[model samples]
Target: MNIRFDGKRALVTGAGKGIGRDVVKKLVECGAETIALSRTQSDLDSLKQECPSIIPVLCDLADSESISTALKDCGPIDLLVNNAAIAICESFFDANTADFDKTFDINVKATIVVSQIVAKGMIERKAGGSIVNVSSQASLRGLKNHLIYAASKAAVDSVTRTMSLELGPHNIRTNAVNPTVTNTAMAKVGWSDPVKVKAMTSLIPLGRFAEVSEVVSVILFLLSDFSSMVSGSCVPIDGGCVAS
Candidate 1:
């Protein structure tokens, strides 16, 4: 199926690097007017250089006020990608309040807040929109040292389902993408050891981790008209890891 987002406006958080960066680039290529939010100005500058059509916004997801201020003048966005997240790997017994708070603030709370703000605009304009939350496979299955991170993402999945029910009346769709260990710099640090890679890959039916583009493809699909009836779902981009 040919999916095109011509004339649509999309906003992606954590758009400075990794999956977010790839999503922004792909959105632009698909003819969408993209607004990218990132904490680093240099990364935004590099993104702008690569895709001149994208509008960059500097925002820290951890702060509630920052999210509101950054999106204040972003105009009406038809697609929202809540992709900003941080993983503080600590065992359940050892995880502290600070780590839990920080993880939830960015991964869960910020996603809800951003979607609320953007959805308000969409409702006001009478133009229904699509929202995709970037969650993790750990949310569905237990992972070592991912206690807090997994919990935060599980909350994200809940938010997706709840929002879909509330927003469906307004013709707004909400969903989440749960990807397994992706080939990104941040993830590479954890899976760098050959033993770790083999152990993890062996469990995946596909016998490989996902590439950033693979995740982006699913994000774009959900955002496009191709997934008009899809909502309140957690689409796994795990290369068959969930299946295994």
Candidate 2:
């Protein structure tokens, strides 16, 4: 029952900040060799400074070529946490088509691409691996102005299920962690405007957002042997939002 990932290798996307950053830190603490990927070199450097055990990789997940190259460069991994995502706060109709494309490309396509690359290695080696995708409550329930974001996450949920079936024989478990509004840098955008923040706070049953570490803790459980039988599942970390 001791959930330890000692000697395992992990790769976490968008790990330069927010929940992804916490995920990487937790993995390192759990004795896993973690490679943190992000687009910002400075953020990657900061993560390296904070967790010297974590190797930082600079790559934009939205860029397919960059993602393919980076994962290949990193060689193989036992855990892949697809935690990078983007959202467009504008109304569905008002949001530019380009924004929608960008959101899906990163939230869905990139995840698919990276999983393929990493899973291939895991399969070939006959090594059991785990993939924890970062989904959202939006994928389970609808939200205003969540058109593109919701669609992308919904796709991720579907991919998780499909991958479980396809990769099960290879012993690769694919699952997702669905979190409600969290107090990360991503959540503060637009909502940082006091009025917007107040509006959002009113919607949650808990009347508050989650701390990044809280989400990371669940992610670590899923990544470790603690969740050995879990696959194709969407575990919610929402604060009473789904309950209500």
Best by TM-score: 1
- What's the distance in Å from true for residue 227, model 1? 0.8
The whole-model C-alpha lDDT of candidate 1 against the native structure comes to 0.93
Local distance difference test values of all predictions, in order: 0.93, 0.87
Clash pairs (backbone) in predicted model 2: none
Q: How far is candidate 2 from the true structure (C-alpha RMSD, Å)?
A: 1.6
TM-score of each: 0.98, 0.94
Which regions of candidate 1 fall more than 4 Å away from where they truly are?
none
lDDT tens readout by residue for model 1, 155-185: 9999999999999999999999999999887
Q: Tell me how far the alpha carbon of residue 104 in candidate 2 is from the true structure, in angstroms, after superposition.
A: 0.9
TM-score of candidate 2 relative to the true fold: 0.94
RMSD of each: 0.9, 1.6
